[model samples]
Target: MGKKGILLVNLGTPDSPEVSDVRRYLDEFLMDERVIDINAFQRTLLVKGIIVPFRSPKTSKLYKEIWDENGSPLLYFSKIQAAMVQEKLGDEYQVELAMRYQNPSIASGLDRLKAGLVESIQVIPLFPQYASASTGSVIQKVMELVGKWQTVPPISFINSFHDNELMIDTFAENAQKYQPESYDQILFSFHGLPERQLKKCDHTGQHCLKKDDCCSTLTDVNKFCYSAQCHDTARLIAKKLNIPAEKYSVCFQSRLGKEPWVQPYTSDVLKALAEKGKKRLLVFCPAFVADCLETLYEVSVEYHEEFRALGGEEVQLVASLNDDPKFIDALVAMVKN
Candidate 1:
């Protein structure tokens, strides 16, 4: 008889918010085929020759904005999360924290667990939704590393917890703190993926965007679709908060060099709302479990500025589930069962 091993993985951060470190981080992150979904040579040219060279300094500055005296918010909170889960789980399990793309790599996390010689291992990729780029990449990387082991322990992975009740409640509870009714509209904005990625996830060839309201509800045809899961997550949170369907919009953000990404883009949605004379806005970024660059800098600063310039009064972000006791409790439940 033996204890279970738990490994938690999140999308990574740069070693530091310096230009060189940011460049290295971006190169590693964007070069993933799952991420950019382009031919290797073209990805290299786009990432190395263009993005890394041009965007590194700009991105470093964004990281700097979110970075604090304690360092990267994502990593900082991730550390607290792992420690808390470990403490609550007691000596029955050993918990390890990892990042999909950077320091405290998945390899190290798995190795540490294997050293613990537990009877089984459970891997929880921190992304709430399942996407080829994020959760899928982590699964593939974990398998690729552990597949080499001579004696592999029985292992399981949590693919997605988008509709996890406790998790959704946590997000809704966070939004309630800001008085959701005070805002003119609520936006549930998720990180964007290229339309091609959505198509690839569509098991039925004709299901994706081929019919009206394709992503309006989740079904077998699009159950694994990232956009659908994102929509489902938003719907659950909104329903929990008693928000009417018309009062909120499900949108996507952080698109880059896009041919097209799952739309309506958050930026475009804000413009539409502004044109309609909707001033105050409340935004929930449920995609990210911890408050990082995307939630803290992009949503809070960049989007707010853009919206205000468009004549919107305010764009307030609902804080993420960062080491919140309730969030950690939800995580502990997922780990246990």
Candidate 2:
């Protein structure tokens, strides 16, 4: 018998805040078919020819703002998480950390595990809610690499842990520090997805955007739906905190292009709340387990500025569950059983 191999993967970050490095990272990330969902030629034309070229310089600046002596927050926290998980799991488990894109590639992580001669490999993508562009891409890429191995071991994947009790509690627990009641409006802002993507997840041709209840309720027909899972996550957290259903709003953020993304965008919601005289706002980005550019820069800085310009007083972002002991305990339990 050999040690169990645990591969922990996060979204990823650029090697540095430099424009060149950011460009490379963007090219690799946006070029993913799952991400753009366009033909290869078209995606290449858009990502390489336009998006990466124009966006990289501006995006690098944002990365620089969040970048510290520890470098990228995502990778830094990911390293800490891997170490903690390894320490907790003990010698019986060989844990490796990788990013779905960029440095510490999945190939290197899997190679180390393969060298360790582990009996089985457990893959846990650090995305609370499942989405095709994220967890699905990681799974697909892992399979594409491992399929070529001559001596492949038993492999397992944690598909989605959005409704995990401890995970939900962790977010609620973090918000407790912020005093949720003090805020005028609470926003559970998740990363946005294209409307077409949600439609693709819909097994039934008519079940997607046609129905309104699907977003609030999780059913087998739309169980794999990303929007539904995000809403369910918010619901669980709100329930745990004894928050009223009408008190907080669920919105999506970080959308690209002009296509209609998941509705009630965070920007629009913030603007509306500002106009409604809801000055103090609290935001929870549960989709992200670790504090990254999205949570730190986008939600904290950008959204705060935007809201203030709209006559809002504050846009306080609740901290993420980075290296939290409770989260690690839940992770270990997932791996063991």
Candidate 3:
């Protein structure tokens, strides 16, 4: 056996908080057919004319707020993860990090791996749960690129690791510092996907959004459903934390556009918790493996203020698995497995 290459992928971020960079990153990301899931002309119009133009400046400002001295947390941590995984794997495996969008792209990562002439490649999209806009997109892009190679080495894509014990344990461990029992309620908030996307993944056609508890239980039919997987991930973490079913809520956040997204929305849940006199809340975003704009700015900063306005005392966001040693070990286990 020869050297095996490992490409760790995460959702991309802008090269900088600058408006132009953000607009460009958004353009590449939203333009993906799997992401927007619309016709070419309509997608182009929406991304360029309306979405990017309107969202870039505002998003750029938010990025500026979350930007660290090292830069985008997602990218920064991803690079560290790649280096760490490489070190753990030793010289037998060459590891590289790439973002599904923007700089340090899949193309560059693949190029480096190809130069090594590795015997095989394992592509790990950092999303814990499978989503068409995320892990699916990464897989699609990788296949499209590697297909053009004359002799593509044996390639494998780890689609979803939502059920990984170490991954779940990592999140649970992060919440331990907050003293889980102290919070009024614990909220497992995964990044939201469109309802249509969830339903589309239901091959049985009978499952997904058809019943109230459709997502609460994972089934063969709903195994690939993003919402179902998210709920299951939450259940595992909650179980580890010894959080009773009634004391925890599984919700989705970062919804975009006017069309219905996966419910119940985290924003709505937060308000409802406040109305119900649940003063303190602890939020866990298991969907994301690393802290990015969604976890940092949207959840910690934005949701904190929103919860405060709703009479909620505190909205504490559990830290993400960003370059944590245990998380790196989890990644190593996944790769070795």
Please state the error at residue 298 of candidate 3 in Å: 0.5
lDDT of 3 by residue, 58-109 (tens): 9999999999899998888888888888888899999999999988999999
Where is the poorest 10-residue window by lDDT in model 2? 205-214
Looking at model 2, the pairs that clash are none
Q: Taking the tens digit of each residue's C-alpha lDDT, what string does model 1 give over 1-337?
A: 7889999999999999999999988999999989999899999899999999999999998898888998999999999999999999999998999999889999999989888888898999999999999999999998999899998899899999999998999999999889999899999999999999999997778899896589889998888889999999999999999999999999999999849889999999999999999999999999999999999989999999999999999999999999888889988999888
C-alpha positional error of residue 89 in candidate 1 after TM-score superposition, expressed in Å: 1.0
Looking at model 3, residue 282 earns an lDDT score of 93
Q: Is candidate 2 or candidate 3 better by lDDT?
A: 2
- Each candidate structure's TM-score, on Cα atoms with residue i matched to residue i, is 0.98, 0.99, 0.99
Question: What does candidate 2's lDDT look like per residue over 204-263, in tens digits?
Answer: 877888966668889888888999999999999999988899889999999999989998
